[model samples]
Target: MFQGWNALLASVWGCCLIGFTWGQLSDSPDVLRNWCLDSDYHKPQPGPEPQLFSECSPWKERSCCNATVSKLIHHNVKVWHGFQFRHCPPQVSSECLRFFRRDFCFYECSPNLGPWVEFEYARKSRQQRFRNVPLCASECEAWFHACKDDLTCVRNWGSEFDWIEGTNRCPENAKCQLIRDTYADAKDFCETVWDNDFKYTPDNEPCMVLSFDPSSGNPNDNVTEAAISRHMNSINSMLNRQRIMERSFSCRISPSIAVSRGIPKLVCDFSFREFDKMRQLKGKPKETPRQKKERKQDFSPENQHKALRVALPIFVGFWVLIGIFIYLNTRPKH
Candidate 1:
């Protein structure tokens, strides 16, 4: 029993280190790494796992999830976090549902989401989210074709659904319609269904596919690494160009804008090359690259506070872990 507690205490300390490391990562442009969400289901870090189950098997060589979660999400469960597929009368088709399962497997298991990882500001707890992930055009087409005949009432599955008794139900104002009727095209379906989590792309350029044959290769690995490299080169080029003046972005929130829809937007002119790809998504017009120079703010006070919030808990936890370890080992035992 004491030995088990020792391992548990050690794990808590490791989580503390991860918290501090991630806080530092936000301030440092040179460091990016494969990361998993701080979720109850995810492992601390991504690594090789050879025995993942069913549709999730393709990620077995490198995954953020274990076989237990893969099996649970595939077999023993049909709903997660109050979301379910049986919102319409005819219900979702098996093939269509399988496509969704594969997508979930990718989201929960693949560590390649690093380049697009962002924070879920809406959640009180710290959680990582993927933003504007570019999906291979073929997979989007395939998913849409399979599900077109199925029924749904909402465009955005992430936040538009209504839940009752812990399962999703169509909103009171919504009437079920065919998936094709709900979304204009595969691109629209991919982009809006998850509220911009995925950006559909027609280009043959390296993009992520939800499911792949392991015998061939995992394109996700190549795609994210390439994006990171491209992003680094872009950053280095910008710094070299601005070495004398050090240009950076300064965004301001336009809180007084009347007739604003939903959340307020932050307005800014600064831009980066890799971020340009996402501008092409959802019919958003791309802004011309600007060369105006502004002083780069490295670790502002607000960032310092954020770092402190992350670090304070870690510091307390480390001492607490040490205390527990010492108590267990030094205390008299029968």
Candidate 2:
């Protein structure tokens, strides 16, 4: 009888867990779409960080790290992963240090790292990480050139740094060397640091920025949404805890993502056609499957200009049709 009772309780617990997982997946594709990483570090959701440090301010509009974390990141007093930038000769120059700080800013603060987030299978602490995020060639070249003359003891900051006394020190018998000499070239420099966390993309392409002019609108936002939209479409089928394919970063994330799971994604602006379809759905009684699918596929804002172009015509035509119908109905038995 005790065995039977235990079995029943286990079954009930499993079902409840499964229900919770499905609930997260069934949420609005838009809300379910954008998220931060699930770790000791990130916030439950990305929101305004108005008080973020000036160096990390570019992400203030939407950030994973709060003001406290931003402040921590800016201070050299906070030792990260046992790293010491001064582990080599001729100390990291201010220009080169700025580049490193910007890189950390993006990793620690930006909500835009969504597309590349993945689980680390072999990691002992098992923190999820973003992989192969694209960096603009110009930025990569600039980073490389800025630090080329500076010295670092290791080629891969992720794996090779030898931690000691709560900070990194040069490995045994390893000599310090110039950054340019440490890496083969600009592409090699970008890819090899931190074990291929970044890939170089040429200018005018849809690469991300470590820093940007936020006033003009963020180019990376479009890239993130497009990738998320693709992930959403593929997840249409029910995913039980076992089958793993790709992403997410809130409690909104699933059991599968709790393990090593990820997917890279596409980049483009949201589309206006989707905006039109969404508008039409307001107050509708029901929708056909085709309509539902169309709505799902239309991730928002393909282009800001395009949305305005499409929406304005619909607004004008609706008024024009109303005028014509009113005129005909009022005509003398026409």
Candidate 3:
């Protein structure tokens, strides 16, 4: 009984699987047909074929009574009528009929049909051999104008608000302001606004800078630049004030002569002197060793004493050697 139950379950599952597979296969065409129901999706239906009849009847004449005559005069006008006539022959085949049905369905019932049928298979053939034709200057100019307008709109929208807002248009709550200022001031304002929401700076000396060129073709150029400028200036001024308040405490530098006499000072002085010399010799070539050595050297007493100690020993040794050589020469007679 368990084995029978297992068999029944297996059969039910198999049937379900088969049904699912069949549904999957059939649903594709149904879905496509439903999609074709949309008004925009148009496809042409296949046209009806014209009917043909024989001009003369078989019983009209004795000649028609002949088998060959009957065969010649039968419905041979339409090839689908089969080759019952001798003068005309039917070219119809089972394969041709199947092909025609399929071809008709594809070019008639399918969503791609209108354009395909209007252009025929030549449409696909042309697309396959498509060449990238260069646009004329006029065409490019027109496209550029359209692209420029779109880009301008996008830029305006992006600048006006954060992306959270759906519409590209600016919110009514925010008043747009414009200020013209030096590049430096403008940069300071922008930086302040970005870092600390709408702050002022010492550079808050705002100028009325035009956001868009009034002379340019943009219509939005007429919009009040002053409002934006004031907002920017206010932010800049706030930031500037904040920065000033933060730095209000004076920085004290303790007076220390010892620090002035340090290695850093020596290095700085030496570098400064060298820089001055270089400047003096500007456009002049470097001096030779002899020219450089011509400068007077100021030796301190200690340095002079050290130099004397080194030279005195060498001088005394030279004198002793000379005397010994003279004595040896004079004593040669001994």
TM-score of each: 0.63, 0.59, 0.14
Model 2 lDDT on a 0 to 1 scale: 0.69
Worst 10 residues of 1 by lDDT: 244-253
lDDT string, candidate 1, 74-117, tens digits: 87445755567877876568899899889889988987777777
Off by over 4 Å in 3: 1-298
Which lDDT tens digits does candidate 2 get at residues 1-334? Answer: 3334435545664575556444233234454335676666678688888898867788888888898877777786225545678778656788888888888778777777666766666554336677787888989999999999998878988888776776677889888899989999899999888898888888776688898876676667876676566655544433321111112221113333333323222100122233234445776546768888888667556655677899999999999999999998898882
Which candidate number maximizes TM-score? Answer: 1
Which window of ten consecutive residues has the lowest lDDT sum in model 2? 242-251
Q: What TM-score would you give candidate 1 relative to the actual structure?
A: 0.63
lDDT of each: 0.72, 0.69, 0.30
Estimate, for each residue in 225-323, the C-alpha lDDT of model 3 and write its tens digit: 332343346546644433322222111021133234332445445444554454467777467566665543336677788999999999999999999
Please list the residue runs of candidate 2 whose C-alpha ends up more than 4 Å from where it truly belongs after superposition: 1-33, 121-126, 229-334
Alpha-carbon deviation at 71 in model 1, angstroms: 0.6
Candidate 1 ranges with C-alpha deviation above 4 Å: 1-33, 124-126, 246-334
Best-to-worst TM-score order: 1, 2, 3
